[model samples]
Target: MPIAITGPNGLLGREVAKVFKKEYDVIELPHDILDITDLNQVREVLSNHMPTVLVNCAAYTAVDKAEEEPKKANLVNGLGVRNLALACRDLSIDLVHISTDYVFNGNTDTPWRIFDVRDPINAYGYSKYLGERYLETVNPKYFLVRTSWLFGIGGPNFVSTILRTATKQTELRVVNDQFGCPTYALDLACFLFKLVKTGAYGVYHVTNQGITNWYDFAKEILRQAGINIPVVAVSSDEYVRPAKRPKNSALDPFPLKETVGSLPPFWQDALSRFLSETQTKECLD
Candidate 1:
């Protein structure tokens, strides 16, 4: 059976299409072709395709800007997910929705469990939380995989930003107060595919193992590129954005490991592969 991947041109969706195509028939329906926010469009397009699985990668991910344009974010993130959930329910299709750690309130120190009390502090977080609630309510057979700090070849990411900044400036300041596990889009794509096969329908934390703050993550990215740059560790207060970020973005993958029988390698290993695959000598050197 063919699989329909929404937002197929996105950072994670591109990887998902590439990986899943090797195993299953894949149909790429980006926003131009299938608007998840439009319920009529969603139903018309998905019914025409009739894929067995629908992996929703569509999202409005402008975090800081989300504060100013919350309605746009909620419409895309919350209403869009709801539309898909309804369509999947009608079509008898399995849904794998890409979620974020932002759904958490940035309060917990330990990795958030599946049933943690969600308290979203910022607009973006609140919007994602709404999406999660809508999806779970509308569909019982769905896999909500939450990942964070993703980087890959398909789009601009934190890793690319850091490397690009290092070329023009010797000293880079990054926030050390915020912590998370950086995920390679490909690794996460593979894990999602694995989940699709297992039919393990529930919420699961999916990120590359281990954690680091922004400053250390920048350091590691520079080290992998063989670039020497002075990284300044600044507090979150020192560099404020329009949106409030999670001080604790790290996720526990114990549920994923127990269900799938294995987990992706540490984020460092993923970063090394990303650099080798995407970075040219001009970018690294």
Candidate 2:
């Protein structure tokens, strides 16, 4: 049976489609084609596609802006998820939904596990958490995959932002307080495919193995690109933003390792692969 993927135009969605296209009948649906917020539209798409698997990559990911636009965030991340879960339940289809580390309050010094209690710190996090809860409660066949610090070729991401700034600036100041694993979209896509094929349906924390602050991530990006820009580190207090970040949000891979029998490679290796595949030399040139 075919698989229907929402947010097909986004970074992770695009990668998922690319990876799954060879093995499965992949149906790519962007928001312009089908807004998931509308239950009727969601039902119609699901009915027409009649997919065995539904991968929900669409979300309201504007962390800071979500505070100002809580309603829209909730509608897309929370209600949209509920609509999809209900439809999937009725259709007896499996669901693989993408989530974020923002679901945690970032208060814990240790890495977060699947069974960890979630207490989101921001509106965006809360909305995503609500989606997770709804899916778990309503749907029996679901994979709640939580990831963080994602970047890829299809969308503007942290790596691209840093590369762009490094070209024109001699020095860059990055936040060093917040810590988490940086995930590559392609790696995540491949892992998701394996999970589906194996039929290991549950919440799994998928990301690069090592954890680092944003400052270090920026420095590594510049170093890999052969850029000579100076990436200086600054505390979160010095570089304040509209949204609050967790001091430490590294995810533990005990469940993934135990279930999947292994874990994804380190973040640096994934980043290197992404740079090689995307041929980011254009950006440096």
Candidate 3:
């Protein structure tokens, strides 16, 4: 059976394509080739391929920019998902939709469960929530995975940004209030591969097993890279952006142990592997 992936060029999408290609016949559908926002186009493309599984990595991920261009965000993340869900439902294609932790209100101290009430505070979160609703309602055979603090090689991410800034600066000020798990895109991709194989059709919360604030995460990044730098911790208010981020967006991997047999490797281990891969890529270039 062929597996089609949307947004295959994105951070997690790239890794998902790589992982799935190793075992399955993968159909890579970049936005230019398959604009999911266009319903007729989505139907036409999926109908032509008729893949067994459709991995929707396509999303409006510009967190801060979403504040200004909410319509565009909803178009891609909200109604765009409805298009895919409708087509998948009609075609009986299993939909593997990637979601986010932003759907929950950040005020809670504990980790968010898979069935937690969704109360998104920002435009981006609301848009993703809309997609979740559409997918849940339209497609029954779907894997709705919600993750957070993604850093990967396929695109510009926090890890790359921090490393780049470290070269020129002596000290870095990162938000210490916002806490969540740091997920390596490759790790997440591998998890999705394992998950889709089990025929488990429900919502799942997945991330590298652990929780830490941005300041601590940045310090670890510098430490793992063997870079000596001072990471100054600051409150969220001090580093405010166009978007209001949740203070705590940590997702609880409750059902993952039962579904996948074990929790993912610790966040530190994933970080080490990511740094090694980053260094190797840099050297090869």
Computed on alpha carbons, the lDDT of every model, listed in order, comes to 0.92, 0.90, 0.93
Question: Using TM-score as the measure, which candidate wins?
Answer: 3
Query: Could you tell me the lDDT of residue 129 within candidate 2?
Result: 90
lDDT at position 166, candidate 1: 92
Q: Write one digit per residue (lDDT tens) for candidate 1, span 1-285.
A: 799999999899999999999999999998889988899999999999999999999998988889999999999999999999999999999999988999887787898887888888889888898899999999998999989999988787999999889999979999999988999999999999999999989999999999889999999999989999899999999999999998998888868988888999999999999888785744775
Backbone clashes (count) for model 1: 0
In model 1, the runs with Cα more than 4 Å from the true position are: 280-285
lDDT value for model 3: 0.93
Of models 2 and 3, which has the larger TM-score?
3
The TM-score of candidate 2 is 0.96
Residue 60 in model 3: lDDT: 92
Q: Whole-model lDDT for model 2 versus the true structure?
A: 0.90
TM-score of every model? 0.97, 0.96, 0.99
Screening candidate 3 with a backbone cut-off below 3 angstroms (N, C-alpha, C), the clashing residue pairs are: none
Arranged by TM-score, best first? 3, 1, 2
List pairs with backbone clashes in candidate 2: none
> Which is superior by lDDT, 2 or 3?
3
Worst 10 residues of 2 by lDDT: 276-285
